[model samples]
Target: MSSNAALLFQGGIGVIGLVAMLLFGIPVLLVGPGLWPSILLGALGASLTYAALLLLTRVPGLFPENLERQMQGLYDFASSYSPVVLILLSLLAGVGEELLFRGAIQGWLMANTDPVTAVLAASVLFGLVHYVSFTYFLVATGLGLILGAAYVLSESLVLVMVWHALYDMIALYCLLRFPRWFGVRIVDPVTNRPHE
Candidate 1:
């Protein structure tokens, strides 16, 4: 499929999943109103995840070059669109993925298992759905762990949604505006070693 078509398909699927979760899963989970504290914690969690990525990027050979190339290719494709489209796409990804992984799956798991197990299961599923690569899967799983922890702490999906959306926007902007920073072959400033 064309990139645009793929994005549309993803967004449409996400919307459908979110709606289904809201209509069916919410009542089944007995989810209550959002708590301010949980929301704040969720925001913190998202910020921390972004910060962690920033730190990781600074380390030489931390992430595979192939991943950078793949990400750059994606960024190049996304760069063809307007800012509004990018924002909307990011929002779609954030909302749709969170709804399915955190809201529906995690909620269901919490009902039958412990919170830790639920979070891990949901996180693993989240990683698997990406189907990018083992490295990417691991990265996604780590991010999922952060998201899950935030949910457990704040019990607020909205907070995580905002966090995820903001994170995506920041990442998209960086990838578009500063492509050089993501190069695979570079000297690790701290270790003085080649990244590749």
Candidate 2:
């Protein structure tokens, strides 16, 4: 499918996912307002997963060059945007992407199948829906796995939403403020060395 067409399709799916999540998640949230701990744990879990992935990419013999460039580009773009712009971007991403991938898709999977199957299936779908370059796909899939696990652990969409927003905001800040510290150069994923 054309990129535009694919995006539109994904957008539609996202809307559906949001609605479903709100329907089921709200009740859970209302019943157990004290599930904040789970939510916090979920956020921590996601952060660890992301860090691990970054470290893995730095490991020798496992990195992909194209993937590294893509990551660097993403960091550069986020770093370039103003704080207000980044906030807006994060809000939109948290609402749209989270709703579609974690809320709607994950909700459906949890209802129809076991949690393990649901998480794996939803993560795959989330990854496939991007239809971007391979590196982008891998990053997104890794993110999906982290987010999916968060949802399951917390059983609260709100926690994942907040975590997602916070994560994006921090990434944007890091990209903008400490670009060099974060390794601005694109590294070859396979060799874990800077790409020349």
Candidate 3:
């Protein structure tokens, strides 16, 4: 899909999150201070995720051929867009998804349940929605856990939003810029040639 269309679609997610927040009567101002720390922490989360992917891909028989194929297909689509557009999409997804999953669903769960339950429940839901393969489900769930932890730590949706968005943006950047880092051998869309 065109990046513009992707933007519109992602924007709708933010709207849905907002509607859910309002309908559920969840407070919207969970955003707090600590902006600098949030950015650094978000970047760290992205780095850790990248390292995990590298390590996981190296484990023999762990990442299946089919899952690798699916990921390649996704990378092809993601690499078709401009970096700026992709980053924007990441931001939208971060805000929209974190808002609903963390702010609304997790927030509601925390109100009714314990923090651990809320994080696990919301992370599982996040994983389910992003499920492409079992491995991917696990990875997405792991990412959700990271975001949820950030939220719990700072009580700031803004922090998790930064973390989630940075994680996505970094992942996309890595997938396109260094496919072999994840054990894939595909054409680098930017250079129109395979990675060396």
Indicate which candidate wins on TM-score.
3
lDDT of all predictions: 0.73, 0.65, 0.81
Between prediction 2 and prediction 3, which has the larger TM-score? 3
- Model 1 ranges with Cα > 4 A deviation: 1-7, 19-44, 64-66, 184-196
Ranking of predictions according to lDDT: 3, 1, 2
Please report how far candidate 2 places residue 126 from its true position, in Å. 1.8
* Candidate 1: clashing pairs of residues: 38-154
Model 1, 24-85: lDDT tens digits are 65422212345565456556766777778878868878776466766666666766788887
TM-score of each: 0.78, 0.70, 0.86
Model 3, residue 176: what's the lDDT? Answer: 85
Clashing pairs in 2: 17-104, 63-189, 63-190, 64-189, 64-190
Per-candidate clashes come to 1, 5, 0
* Model 2, position 53: C-alpha lDDT score: 65
- Residue 91 displacement (Å), model 2: 2.6
> In model 2, where do residues sit more than 4 Å from their true spots?
1-16, 20-39, 181-196
As for model 2, its CA RMSD to the true structure in angstroms is 6.8
User: Between candidates 1 and 2, which one is better according to TM-score?
Assistant: 1
**Candidate 2 lDDT, 78-162, residue by residue in tens:** 6555566667666566556777777677667777788888788888887887646776677777778877886777566776776
